[model samples]
Target: MSDTLIDPPADGPTERPLPLRPALEAVLMVADQPLDSVALATAVGHPVEDVVAALQTLAEQYDEQDRGFELRHVAGGWRYYTREAYAPAVEKFVLEGQQARLTQAALETLAVVAYQQPVSRARVSAVRGVNVDGVMRTLLTRGLVEEAGQDVGTGAHLYRTTGYFLERIGVSSLDELPELAPYLPDMEDLEDELERVGGFQTRPDEQPGDQPGAATPTEETP
Candidate 1:
């Protein structure tokens, strides 16, 4: 990041929030997945129209400056990705060894996305009792899951297993999957459980209350 990007203007109000574009950049820097305009608006305390404009300007500025990364809007949210031209370098650095298999957490996260999608990571986290952002990224990179769209009510980005997932799993379609939904707790009981307890399991990040840096879904994740 450029010093200019990180530093606020000397003339600007010291007590005021970071400017829209820079604030968006700050938030995007740490996000593990795309975040919708509504979520960004909520986080930055900006209107949706302003956030959209700021994102577009940032994207244009990066392209004009020939930066090494790009801002992309996928589904209903936006995220930063290394520019495509730099993919080879990233791949070389990141894929340092022979590819390893997914972790137990990733497998469990995948199962949730496979069966319960189009679902949100928050919900997947609720189901598996751990944050699924990292696992969801792994699945996305592995071509096992993809963004389906946002939830209509909450605007949370939803994910579903991809065609590649079915192919790898030797299933012709989702219809071939086991009937697990039927095994879930009754609807009211499940909501009560989720509301009462975060999930079946939890880590340092999970909690019963609204998740930090998470969109406040009208419904609970668990």
Candidate 2:
């Protein structure tokens, strides 16, 4: 029998595998959504159990170090979040007396959109108990939220938070959004009120694109 020689394909690029931890970190660092163990494992060519173990280890390491940030599981997946202890410093740096900031109403509307994205304008307005047409337009102009697609049932346009929104918030993904339940009114109650008030009946006549505005940082009301 003769020896067989294997030749590399000339037209294809070579593939290199990275070390498990660094590979996981690199992917998580830029991910705009919470990647599960299976997804991470597939991306890094590692076993799902190994990816899960690595994530747990990383979380523990960060906690032991008292780092300003933390690895957290939220919305059913894992991502990074600023440790509560460092929120003040982080906020000061991010806000920086920026004369322009989101208004309270806009902020509230944005939170609803961020949490319930791929949601229709009607649903958003319903949740907020107010017409969100203008606020949604503002969010779109600022590149914080975007048109996701049309809702199959109503044929209404759906919206979701943008990757830019995650970047601005210094979070890797939506899963990292701080828990709002403790601070805000009960969402179920709010939704019930919205329904009773018939909030979802009305919608913006103009589509998101028809709204006119320049993207600019907002100023807090005095």
Candidate 3:
């Protein structure tokens, strides 16, 4: 989906060994984001078919009996990340104790993005009744949300949660979010409900079965 580090193949397949390994490593390294097979192939000057085979090989190598990291496809591209089992050690020392925390503003902005993903910043602001510029910046920095693309009408940047968001939220997919219906309030009772919650927040342990982010019924009227 994005530019990659592999070089385009020469005019023809020369006898020289394809730079498959280095090409993959280069694509994985210094990539601002993940590298998809098509992009990697384009970059490596090899056909996408060949690049894909090489990737499988690399992935299998990492999945061998012993390996510190694994190649994974996330956020629509491929990247090498440490295995989950080593997360604690990596977080405690290698990462200098940095852990992502969502601020109230970030959480609110994230809620809007999650519900109306591929949504423009303008739409998010309209729903939240507050400026979300700062919160959006934080989410981008934290790798929870990213610019999906530009809107068609005004060319406004669209936002969506990244794969990392699912991992952090302990959800495998967006469809896993709980369904909300019974918790929704009637039209006349909108303000009172939000007023009571102090701007709704879900408890961390709340499972997928719990109703969350159920805005008042009036908010549901298109």
Candidate 4:
């Protein structure tokens, strides 16, 4: 028999499975926030335990090599971050010619709001010892905080950090926020003060005698 080569059938090219480390890297490189092992495993079609081990190994290898960026487990998940030593460089690069960065006062207020969410404007002001109405508006405009709901006891609108805030900080959840000393004012005291102060007082545009849940007068037609 003559040695003849047969042509392959034309349906589609065969797809090869991706290697573990490279596949994980590719998924992580584009991630907008930290990804838990379960998510990474599902994406790579691998076991969760195996993904966890792989991530640990990758982190160790990066550390050994003194890489500028390292794999870090943060916010209950894994993500790559520039080493702390290089933060200044990264900040400079990101802020180059960018003048719209949040001010120091806004950042402090944001921190308080973040740590004490579902909080009222009065509570925030009490904590910071200053009026935060304008700063709160700025945070709202920046999409960092949003109205959670009105306090049942105080009738004051409560605020909480938004998902956009998490994305901006590269955290998966609020639980990942750094721990702080428990020096915040007592919640009970704040509530009591709010109750005594008439709780967020009605907006200035409302009628003097208007009360919450009250019926509004209708216009009369001729």
Q: Can you tell me which runs of candidate 1 are displaced by over 4 Å?
A: 1-22, 31-67, 71-79, 91-98, 179-182, 186-188, 193-222
Clash number for each model: 1, 3, 7, 0
Please give the ranking of all candidate structures by lDDT, highest first, separated by commas. Answer: 4, 1, 2, 3
**Residue 119 C-alpha lDDT in model 2:** 75
- Lowest lDDT 10-residue stretch of candidate 4: 213-222
**Shift in Å, residue 4, candidate 4:** 99
- Screening candidate 1 with a backbone cut-off below 3 angstroms (N, C-alpha, C), the clashing residue pairs are 35-77
Estimate the TM-score for candidate 2: 0.44
Best prediction by TM-score: 1
* lDDT, model 3, position 84: 89
TM-score of every candidate relative to the true structure: 0.58, 0.44, 0.39, 0.43
Error of 2 at 167 (Å): 24
Query: Candidate 2: which stretches are off by over 4 Å?
Result: 1-16, 97-222
Worst 10 residues of 2 by lDDT: 208-217
Higher-TM-score candidate of 3 and 4: 4
Q: Which of the two candidates, 1 or 4, achieves a greater TM-score against the reference? A: 1
- Total residue pair clashes for candidate 2: 3
Ten-residue stretch with the least lDDT total in model 1: 200-209
As a TM-score, model 1 comes out at 0.58
* Residue 43 Cα positional deviation in candidate 2, in Å, after optimal superposition: 2.0
How big is the positional error of residue 36 in model 4, measured in Å on the Cα after superposition? 48
